[model samples]
Target chain A: MGLKRNVGLMEALRYQGKGPMLTYILHRIGGLSIVIFVGLHILAGYLANHAWGANLGIFINSIYENWLFQVFIFFFALFHAINGLRIVILDLWPKLIEYQREAIWLEWFVFLPIYGIALFVIVRSGLGG
Target chain B: MKTKQRPAPLGGFNFDYIMWLFTRLSALAMYLIVIVALTGALLMSARQNMSIADLMRWAFMPNPNHVASTNIPDIEVWKTIFWQVMAILMLFFAGAHGLHGLLNVVEDYISSRRIRMSLRALVLVIWVAISLIGITVIVTS
Candidate 1:
């Protein structure tokens, strides 16, 4: 028997292995989110930069200034950036591949706090601080 | 019927292997560009207390603030060129790299070969379109 057939949501959610797939899934999500964000960013940025697009620019700006959107965007960007750096480092030095588990730990431990602080400043300033 | 065995690499060069390599390279470059863009954005926003609309206007237009302060005629020109070039490069590499990675994810998750191929085609088309728009904007700017 090869690939398992037709696993539903609950079945997929139930882990059957020793190693967790959280990071794997996160990496995929991060990549997908960033791509979508980048597309919207380009469209909005272009519109905002246009001569006759002030109203649309304002509309997009209002959305961008939302605290929740900022947090998600920041988190997505940070996660993708840090994890990408890890992958790059490992690829260049395959010997360090063995430390991938640690790399993921370092990614969260070191970067998350940094991002959190940055988020605090951004949100504060964003909200008329 | 679903194919049981993993498909071989696309060609002699190994499409998956090459894409794997390219993804890392492009991702590293993309990360650097994002850092630069983000830092610039944050600084500009904080300095001017700028809304997104204001930021966009300031970015694409000649910087009236800088002109008022520095009285530098070509500074805005250079800044525009720099950001435009950066945007183009970021879009090109990011589009390729992100779509490639997403295609890999599609392959992993989609069991039906037909659907996988179709999704990959869609990703490729969108990526190319976005990249072209990015380049066109930069060129026009």
Candidate 2:
């Protein structure tokens, strides 16, 4: 059997799988975000230390250091970590598959407070508070 | 008495299986490293001496150079081979796990076997370059 390749963007948008669908999309986005962030972070570190690339390194660091960027990175990192953990748990114990939705709710329950505190700190520091 | 039956192996030791396992193990490993680094930082008076940025850098990478610009008077403690190894481990695990995840996502959108192979090769090259550069920086600094 061949893979179905006919799903259009509009069709995708119109489909509503609700919470699972939302989490699925967000997880992918979160994963991609972390990959980009980590890549740039390592590159920046290398550049900052190298004589020829020091300025560029500093430039990249400065960009990510902006509170706005920090907020976005933190959000994705925390979400990815939490969501990944949930997936891992489900994989380890297939019996828990029945509670998948509850697991996601619990994920958010755990995610929000930690993220909230981090967000507050970031915003406060950003505002020079 | 009923005899216990051994389950057959599912597709023994393929690349996808290994990577699937690697993804999970690496996530756990990174968490462990980060926690250990965070604890070490707190012990080193991170809250009192380091800014949020410095603390974060140390937590994520734990390389001595990451804390070089911080207010900590003595960086000598951080300049050990142990932290160097920690940084290298972080670099490799994160690089492999993340790049593999990206490749998986890309592969989902690409149907052609040739295109998939090319993309895998590209991701491999990028991962190697990132790992090498990261290791060099961690070691030399």
Candidate 3:
């Protein structure tokens, strides 16, 4: 609502300049990452299962088989979903914006252990044995 | 150079307020959908010992494994219908949420109102186009 605080490309991309700045950057990145994966998932799933072009089924299957890619997806999803809850809470209670730092710390505290467990599960499953 | 101020609020609200409300609502909806969808996949995958690929195949196609394994005779038919509906809904909401985020980014960096508006329009067009294509894939598959 204020006069535009237009920034240069360098400033725009300089998320590492501050703590909250980094969170903002990562939130956008996390959301965008999931969106990208959604597109890929839809297209690949359609190709693999559809009547006209089941030929590409193996190619799509290979992507799911790739452990590295799967890990990346899991992390993106974890960060996005957790942070999104924080955003929703903050939106509902603007007074808690001051506690943003504590919220993020809690988010990371929860994120690390759960992500570790997810990786363990993936590996234990023999990366989809 | 003089700084331009935003026009007075219309009916005690402004564009920023509307956007704020819109973003919050959409974000919450998108988050809930993602959580339900992912949780279902993870639980089912673990129960079935299914790989992601196998899960995808099983979800979209009328696979025998799922059919024979399910308790309810009509569960597969219900599930296929549910998934198809969810898939399209996810595509639309996710696409809108993503484009709105990107639009805010463009607004942050682009000083000119005209340029920002143009970019937002472009983003919306792209989002709609992609959603249409994705919906088509979901329905016809």
Best by lDDT: 2
Per-model lDDT: 0.68, 0.86, 0.66
Instruction: Compose the digit string of candidate 3's lDDT tens values, residues A65-90.
Output: 67887788777777877787888898
Question: How does each model score on TM-score?
Answer: 0.74, 0.91, 0.69
Which segments of model 1 are wrong by more than 4 Å? A1-8, A16-20, A48-58, B1-12, B32-83
Per-residue lDDT of A7-113 in model 2, one digit per residue for the tens? 66787799989988888898899999988888887899888877999999999889897999989999988898899889888977899999999999999999999
Clashing residue pairs, backbone N/CA/C < 3 A, model 3: none
Residue B16 alpha-carbon offset, candidate 3, angstroms: 4.1
lDDT of 3 at A104: 86
- Native contacts kept (model 1): 0.33
DockQ of candidate 1 compared with the true complex: 0.36
Give candidate 3's error at residue A19 in angstroms.
Answer: 3.6
- Please tell me which model should have the higher DockQ, number 1 or number 2: 1
> What is the DockQ for all candidates, taken in turn?
0.36, 0.28, 0.36
Residue lDDT tens for model 2, B1-141: 222232333677887898898999898899999998999888887888998768988998888877888889888888788888888898888899899999989777765667879998999999999999889888888
- DockQ agreement of candidate 3 with the native complex: 0.36
Candidate 2: docking tier = acceptable
